[model samples]
Target: MHLIHRPDIVASEITPPDVYLDRRRFIGQAAAGAAVLAAGGLLDPRAARAATAPREKLIGVKKSAWTVPEALTPYQDVTTYNNYYEFGTDKADPSENAHTLKTRPWTVRIEGECAKPATFAIEDILKIAPLEERVYRMRCVEAWSMVIPWVGYPLSELLKKVEPTGSAKFVEFSTLADPQTMPGVRGRVLQWPYVEGLRIDEAMHPLTLLTLGVYGEVLPNQNGAPVRLVVPWKYGFKSAKSIVRIRLVDKMPVSAWNRAQPSEYGFFSNVNPEVDHPRWSQAKERRIGEFRKRDTLMFNGYADQVASLYSGMDLRKWF
Candidate 1:
């Protein structure tokens, strides 16, 4: 029942859900959408052309309350133009080299201030909540964007199931550390085992999704396969991928990027154009597959929905 949002836009402006929710219009638009699916294609030197995960398998998944009324970035673009540093720092490194990384035989250890501290099988994680599709606009810190059809469930579902203790004020996520397959592990690019965190309330927000797949298919290794977090209102880096640990604690957890350069990257990380990156203007973003740049939005356009979450705090200070 909860709706998802971008940082600067109102919920109603998201894909015309009202039209789709209507029985007659839904059928008409769906038919129209199907016909237009094949013509558009884009190639990025930063990406690759490869077979995508089975999007057909997701036909049955329920749609989330919101979507972006726009064409998706080419699947090849989403899979290859990735920021997953585990494989390498280059944009195409993930797609080209992540196959060597194993995803099966995975387990996520949940600990810290919770009634239940347990380790769950990767498959079991999928069973915790029913998966659904949310077509969201992903705005990265680098000023580029993509519209991704992510399949997952609200993060609140898992937090509730685990029963976070009252003392738990923040949630920290830790990514896998497989030096054997992840070549980037050898370099000092980032502290190994990348870590990110969210304030407890932020983690519990309805828009915070724990992603398992994309475009209806199980996740590709380069796309944070198996497991990751998708926080639509924040910059993409806040959504830690290939997670292995979820810990609840009273204090805010230090994230990799923020720790490395505290002055540039803040813990809140809400996408706000008013607050420019150290070296560039964030007022406009270059969406992948597009020739023209569009103005960036506050909270990446979800300000109306999520701004209240930080009501008393200064976004400029926190960001």
Candidate 2:
């Protein structure tokens, strides 16, 4: 769905933080007692704490043509209800524990089949391109969804700076795994330095975002601070968080999830309602903040933009 421009309105005029926070606090309190009754237990009391987290305003965030017209999921829900396994398995664990993460002095290493291989500081990465706010529908494999206002430029902008060789057919992303800060990493989850990958074309797609912030603010530690990948068409897991390294390779790199459960998680994890996860149905999803369930869409409603990438391939098989 394309975004409708409202020249009369601006980012600052969107929903006020206090209003949303108060509403979120009420819901969080109510959910604590009625956890099983609220959106199948997706709501948590820890989400209320997200309102207290400090955030800096992001300036010069231009609206993008790729945004959807859906109402945004509240910032509290977006920040607290996350699947960052590096922090912990519970949805609220990231928000509660990710405060230990240190974002500064961060550098993302670019290597492999790229000729201009170099490491870039977080500051340099932010300066690579002007930021744009793209409101995208994020569908998780667990049959949940959210409309997040992601602020960043296209991933292709950064990839171009590295100058990938002709043989660079895939792009692999690696996330930080510091046991001292990220307590969950000390245990055997999937693997250290969580890895995810995409085809060269997918990596270069205009919809593929190298995200830096959300809700017109610097990214929260729980929500992949410093840098992250956001592929809206694919399931949320495809968007690796707290990224530290990007590699260009000739063959498909094994992703953390795919390696952990090859039968359930595929290499190309496009949001296909037709392909069900081993334990759950992918036909419907509960959008955060809403009570009713909505039918899951092909490519999470971005089929018009990304379906052609898999024209001849069997998504069920590839999935």
Candidate 3:
């Protein structure tokens, strides 16, 4: 039995499933079930959401053991519904306004460690690497979740070229700065330029991705456009969008969310249902589109694979 992630369903709002399976069977059965329901005039909202969703490829350097089906929610449903605006309202509205902006001639400045610290043109980066597809469950700080079919490669592969120094302990990421291109940059909602950081170990995690595109197409100008990071373990905000700079450092660089409210966002923003955010409960999340609620799983349902990394530390504090 295969397990497919259906992002359009409001998982938390629904009753828990009686059984679990691998990606293939889950998606196939769910689709079949939804088809039957639709014929009977009882349609699954998620199925409707999936009906409008774009198909994307989740790539990996090699075929992943954890690959799931290509089921996706709509791009507007995903991007436009985002709560990641650094300088404006963190709702879906900012994304609609963002479409008017242009995204090109972008440059990603790479610094810290390595023999060569240089800024690579967006065209050069895309040309150098081929994209692959990988289906990953995306957990957010807001206690909501989604599964994304991301087209990209392991961030570690790119980091290898930069070469970190022995003293480097963390990697700091900075998003694009042009208010002309990003209207959100105009306000002081965040720190002007959004910033995120990851420990050396976290950055090298197999799940950490350097994404280029999604939904079997080039990234929409509003959806980070050129490149971005997709760290499934951390909350979505920690995965800085429209990235423009990456700086390697020996100390922990201050991040936007952490700086805004240290208690809300931590350096290690791993999803822990037990560790509730100040404004919300992390124990359960309301999956988008679906009216039902679902119970939150440890590490957003990846605890079996990643829990060992936090064996002794206090997740309640760090989260």
Top candidate when judged by TM-score against the true structure? 2
Residue-level lDDT of model 3, residues 166-265, one tens digit each, is 8778999998767775666777777868899998888887778888876656665556666989887677778888888999888899999889899788
Clashes of each: 12, 0, 24
Which ranking of candidates, highest TM-score first? 2, 1, 3
The per-model lDDT (C-alpha) reads 0.86, 0.92, 0.73
Worst 10 residues of 1 by lDDT: 39-48
lDDT of 2 by residue, 243-265 (tens): 99999999999999999999999
- Candidate 1 shows a clash count of 12
- Candidate achieving higher lDDT, 2 or 3: 2
Q: Which candidate would rank higher by TM-score, 1 or 2? A: 2
Could you tell me every candidate's TM-score relative to the true structure? 0.83, 0.86, 0.76
Q: Summing lDDT over every window of 10 consecutive residues in candidate 2, give the lowest-scoring window.
A: 44-53
Candidate 1 per-residue lDDT over residues 166-214, each given as its tens digit: 9999999999978999999888898978999999999998889999989
Ranking by lDDT: 2, 1, 3
